[model samples]
Target chain A: MSTWSMALRQSDYYWTLYRRTWKGSVFSSFLTPLLYVLAMGVLLGGFVEADPSRLEGAPSYLAFVAPGLLAAQTMQTAVFETTYPVLSATKWQRVYFGMNATPLRALDIANAALGFVLLRLVLIAIVFVAVLAPFGVFVSVPAAIGALLVSILVGAAIGMPVYAYAVGVPNESSFSLIFRLGVIPQFLFSGAFFPISNLSPALEWLARLTPLYQGVDLTRMLSLGTWHTGPALVHLAYLLVLLVVFHRVAVRRLAKRLAF
Target chain B: MISARGLRKSFQQKGQEPFEAVRGIDVEVRRGEAFGFLGPNGAGKSSTMRMIAAVSPVSGGSLRILGLDPATDGSQIRGRIGVCPQEDSLDTELTVAENLYVYGRYFGIGRAEVRRRAAAQLEFVQLTERGGAKVEDLSGGMKRRLTIARSMINDPEMVLLDEPTTGLDPQARHVLWDRLFRLKQQGVTLVITTHYMDEAEQLCDRLVVMDKGLIVAEGSPASLIAEYSTREVAEVRFGIGENESSAGAVESAVGRRAERVEVLPDRLLIYAADGEAAVAAVHDAGLQPVATLVRRSSLEDVFLRLTGRTLVD
Candidate 1:
């Protein structure tokens, strides 16, 4: 069989597995951002002033936080979705054993899993953007589209490494560590909800090193049309480097784990 | 055909010893033949099977399946081999039909063809009605049948079944055996590992008995029986108390009439060419046993004689 067909088949397999097992989680992913928009944007925005300094020249707190939330939520969903499930397919559930026993190769399974995660990110981003647009958070149609694409790239950039980590280990504790030390730190330091200028220089440097920060910055640039070429290029470069590096690591780890 | 020369595998445990799971062993399985490995647990049957399935790398050996080396051409070799693992590895998230459909796709089968085979295989396993129901809802036997059917979705050239009927009920086992027999008739090479003597006798044309990662004997069931045991076996169960000495009585009773005498915990087995004459000799010797049964010698006796222990032990 052709490589594309094999990859597509694996993609469909994961999609079906995800739909059956994680449909509720998908709905829950959309609900998290919706609640944030309601509780932080509308409820808190009612009392707080719409300061341009706080929002970095966006029209409202809702507008600024909306794009960042979209990007952050996509990263969150994609990272969690890919990590445990991919690990389970290898070690716990052993679904990969059955798949590898067939004509499908390790690269096919990895590509399928990443492709499925991207599809889910697209769906979740659409719902998130649609929900936020009516609240005066639609900066521009092109910017919104750019935000969606950036979300997928950023999520993949963060997630693919976690995927590599997941396939490399044989237990669930490694995933927990990734979430606690890897993902949680990214959430706190990546400037997803707050400005990086407020943090210490040490933390600022560390935040800039993460894919989540690059993603949040990219989304901010796209949504607000406030382009800073140096930082923009740096963020894009960080994400691109992560994609290539982690994708190669993931392929190698999967070949070792599944191909045996 | 599948061939392995000096196949060896070892696992390194953390802060402990490195255990050799499969010692250097050679094997050759011709096409359209049923090959079996009969051994107790921890005897490396599963490990050897895993290497042959191309899902486990050999630590040192030359291994080939369907004329392709598993190390260099694993994907090509695995593309045409179906494997049913010792453990049930079906996807519990999807329905029985979806399980087969997804597996077929893993073999790079087209969507239309996957759907068609999923339907037919489900029917073949008598699980058409449960196709839509989730795998977690199905009975153990039903799930096993689904696993068997799922392995055949690609119509593989060779199928490797590791203890396929390990935990099934008798009726379920019979049904599975029938299905496997039909697959054999269709010219598919089968490589199986089982400790069940009856299962090995019923399914395998030739087999190798393995113990501690080494082959103890290799031959047809009937030939092994003929070589290892007499034509008939007489079983005598004594009603004597636990502390009573029945061994002395049993030895004196059929000691001269039978070719060999085995003293088990619960019963005494007498190996003889004619079981009727052995029983008469035991009665004439004035040993009144509680129960006496005469049956044809089987592969179970051959295995016990060769390994000097029970298959389960």
Candidate 2:
């Protein structure tokens, strides 16, 4: 079989196992987005709508923050899917070694991992948008699709590097540090919650240059339908470059870790 | 079939010195035969098995699997070979049937074919009733049999088993041995690495005794015994810690009357073509052994003769 198909077959293993636990993941996949929209969109958007000073460019905070949350949640879902599960397969459960014993190469396993996580990212993004749409955050259908693209792109960018780190960890405890230090800060400060323009100039620039911020800008512009083609291309370029570069790093790291 | 010439495996160390796990050695595994690597732990048995399975690289020597070079044709070689690793690495989250189905997919098998093989294999391993049970719920022997069944999914030409029965009970080991013997009967080339002498004698058509990363002796089990040992052995124990003191008397009594005599801490092993004659000679010399027993020679005697009782690993 070709490497691509072999890799997908590897993912079929994960997908089949996921079927066993997919019911348990209802809270994260469905409830988390529902509550996020209710608390951040309806409740907090009421206060922000009364005060437009905080939300400058948009009509309401719900419209402004929904797509941005879409981007960040995609990142969260992608990283979560790849971390402990990757560790379980590679180290704890040792299924990767079993895969390596077959015709599947390490590269096939790595690529299949990304494919599986992307599939999950798409599903989570769909759930996020489905909930956000009922909350009246998505303005147009094309804009929602644009936001979905940016979300999966941002997720792929961040997910690849985290997967590399996940496969190398001696245990699972250190993963808490990734969410606390890497993901939580990006969630709060990456223009998803509020405009980066209000932040200190240096911090704002740093945030704007990172991957999630680029995703936030792209998704927010797409959701609001106010994006200029030039800036949209730039943001898309930023996320695309990060995705390509980090995917190479991820494949190499996983291959090195799994090598005999 | 598998062939190796001067196969070596070494692990590189960061700042410290590198360690060679398998020193250069030659080996040939023929089709339709059960070949074994017999040694204690750390004898580089697993390392050699991994290399032959094509999952591990050979550090210094030329090696081939199914007539293909592993360096250039690793994936192709692996496609035709099955490996049952020493560790039970089955997916616990997957049921017994699911584990086999998912593993077969890695070889790019069709879904229907995988299901078919999974069922047939489960029945072959006598785990048909437990197909839907989770791997964690299975016993150690059951897990091992499942592993063996999984290895047969690809219909591999050669099966490499790394201590396949390492942690099994006597009954469990015999069951696995019986299944492996069936595979050998089906004309599948079998390469097994084990530390159990009886297991080696039972399963292997031709075998090599390894010690400290080297092949010390190679032959069929009985041939190894006849060459390195004798037809029978007279084991005489004087008492706890007394064999050392009585070594000289036992040696002189059994001298020339036996092919060789080894004084172990607990007993004296007198190797002779005839154990009864050797016992009479021991009594004729005015030496008294607290306990004496005679038994036919086996692979353990060959190992002791070549590697001595001192553990190399």
DockQ of each: 0.61, 0.71
Residue B177, candidate 1: alpha-carbon lDDT: 94
Could you give the interface RMSD of each candidate, to one decimal? 1.7, 1.2
lDDT of 2 by residue, A1-260 (tens): 67687777876688787798878876778898888888987788778643555564677888888887899899888878889888888777898888888888878888887787888888888888877877667678887887777788888888877887887787889799999988999999999989998899999998988778888888888888778889889988877777788777777777667665
Docking category of candidate 1: medium
Note the Cα lDDT for every prediction shown. 0.83, 0.86
Clashing pairs in 1: none
Q: What is the DockQ of candidate 1?
A: 0.61
lDDT of 1 by residue, B1-313 (tens): 8888888988878898888988888898999999999999999999899899887888987888999988778878887888888877788878888899888878778889899999998888899999899998988788888988998898889999999999889999999999999999999999999999999999999998888898888898888988899999998888756214676776677777788877777787889999988888878888888889999998778878987777998
- Quick one: best lDDT, which candidate? 2
Q: Which regions of candidate 1 fall more than 4 Å away from where they truly are?
A: A18-30, A46-51, A54-59, A168-174, B238-245, B279-290
